[model samples]
Target: MTPPAESCPALVLNADFRPLSYFPLSLWPWQEAVKAVFLDRVNIVAEYDRHVRSPSFEMALPSVISLKEFVPASRRPAFTRFNVFLRDKFTCQYCAVRFPTHELTFDHVIPRAHGGRTTWTNVVTACSACNLRKGSKNLRECGMELKKTTRQPTTIELQLNGRAFPPNFLHESWRDFLYWDSELDPW
Candidate 1:
């Protein structure tokens, strides 16, 4: 039986067959995939067993699709809460322990009240405990120090860091494109 449209998202890839983005695992809705197929914007690399039909045509839902043209990634990664955590690899800069996103918070190395601005250089990821401990105080006043100096990470750096944390849901077709660089473990 054909699955619902919502269940048939297509993993989108670049013309080179590499995923467009790794962190979020680029995907497109079945409708968009089908539209792209009709428009010649993307080539269907794989398909689901499910089929969608219209008055004149019927086609299988794409499971994986690749663009006809390559889209380059931005050179500069955006400075956002998520990017900040990713830049730090979700590790507390002060305590140097890895924490899940939920347990992590952004901290200013120099307290904002002390004239700190929320830029890539001034922000660091901290665990809840560390955040509260260092609350609104300068690093020296809190007697805490960052393991590494925070700075704006390049797009490539962010991409590398993002690879360490994969999305929770990965369709089987996406594995080959996503993990092409990883070495297989010996049995």
Candidate 2:
């Protein structure tokens, strides 16, 4: 027999890595997501186009669902930014200036030649001019200072994976995590 479809829901986050909303992985454009809704306690508002019987003992029959629980502060979200440019918002990290995505380049705060690993904390997105001007040189040597402190990617970032921000992603609660914040969780 084929594996049965699942009704599991996914947790959503705000731009700041704050817990925002939840969605049944299946929910889409038709309706608004609700907060404080999760698991069997939450109701199933819709379903896929095909007909099927509700599975017994399932948590909820979610055509779509949003969870009620805010992610506990204790949970350290994973960072996802396979592309350095998206990780830095197509902006120069050192100068903190926005640029077109195409104009951005990868930068190593600590040059790999000098012991930098290819990790989020060590890298950033930089504009062409910024990258060229600081090429292969440490900030101190270039007499430049980074506008923001570089840190590991946040939970929201880990989910983004260099993909363009999803149009449908900015729902309730998620707004707090998606705007202005640079970090993200690996989905």
Candidate 3:
């Protein structure tokens, strides 16, 4: 497994929240969380430049980045909670009930026995009762309904990285041609 998002580092996004790529913790000068928050995409408009006298090249800053739409600038994704718990908000995605953290389990929206993969789209948070009853059966068979639509990873991975980063920070080295695009913000 990879290192923790905080210590392991984070990825950047475009102003539209499209994922760019991962960056290491030491590569950036700003807070880890802050980098995760602002990095939306790579610098497409501007290219990196280096000086002949200097050994280091310029940092590749974000031309524009997509900020997370649901959470606020103040909050970040919580990776420690695990993806299933994160997707279900720690509540049963089916049944509309809440359970103790331990009592909650991951349920396959599409049963694994039916060829479902262990992807974020196929699994969700569920209470023990709901999961057991729904066990490896199709939803139509059990008359169960999904609370929220399920899909694959969006910013979940990047959000996961940002949880441990510092606040309001981006790498200073990348500022050469990079400028914040507020209009592109709000993904």
Candidate 4:
């Protein structure tokens, strides 16, 4: 069966041929990828079996595309809920158990009532049970110890952490570019 054009998202890579992001698996909808192709902003690293057509033009959809120019990584990552989870590698800082995003929550090491600000250095990812148990109390009071010290993660650190998680779907062509950095076992 022919997959719809919408199902064929193109993996997007920087000029260095690394994905722009990993956890989200840097991708562009077929429409945007085709537009970039027409605008000459990206090079098609691979093409899908699917093709799109107009009255006068038809082109295979891009499965992977690389930008013509490199995009630099940010030095500082944003202090957002998702970023916090990524920084902690989606594990509960107290229990050291991994959970899906929906099951995870952020907890302030020093509860707000105790004058803790919601900043990177004071926040850690926690599962619901951990969050509730630690609610409105300091770690010492709750008898909880964080698996790791809470601190702001560098953008690069977050990026590397993000790579530890791959999106559920990956087109075959993207595999090489996505995991080239992984060390191979010796024969």
Which one wins on TM-score? 4
Q: What RMSD does model 4 have?
A: 1.7
TM-score of 3: 0.41
TM-score of each: 0.91, 0.45, 0.41, 0.95
Candidate 3 segments whose C-alpha is farther than 4 A from its true place: 1-81, 153-187
What RMSD does each model have against the real structure? 2.4, 9.9, 11.8, 1.7
lDDT, candidate 3, 36-127, per-residue tens: 53464223332223211226543433223333543233233333335457445567988888775788888777888899878767788888
Q: Between candidates 1 and 2, which one is better according to TM-score?
A: 1
Q: After superposition, how far is residue 112 of candidate 2 from its true place, in Å?
A: 0.7
What Cα-based lDDT does every candidate model obtain?
A: 0.88, 0.51, 0.52, 0.91
Model 4's lDDT to the true fold?
A: 0.91
Off by over 4 Å in 2: 1-64, 67-90, 156-187
Model 4: lDDT of residue 174: 83
After superposition, which runs of candidate 4 have C-alpha atoms over 4 Å from their true positions? 180-187
Q: For residues 1-187, could you state the per-residue lDDT of candidate 2 as single tens digits? A: 4224442233333323333422112233322332223323333333333233446522322234334343443234433333455556567887888886667777888888788877767878777888788888888999877777777655455445433444444334333333334467899
**Which ranges of candidate 1 are over 4 A from the true structure?**
180-187
lDDT of 2: 0.51
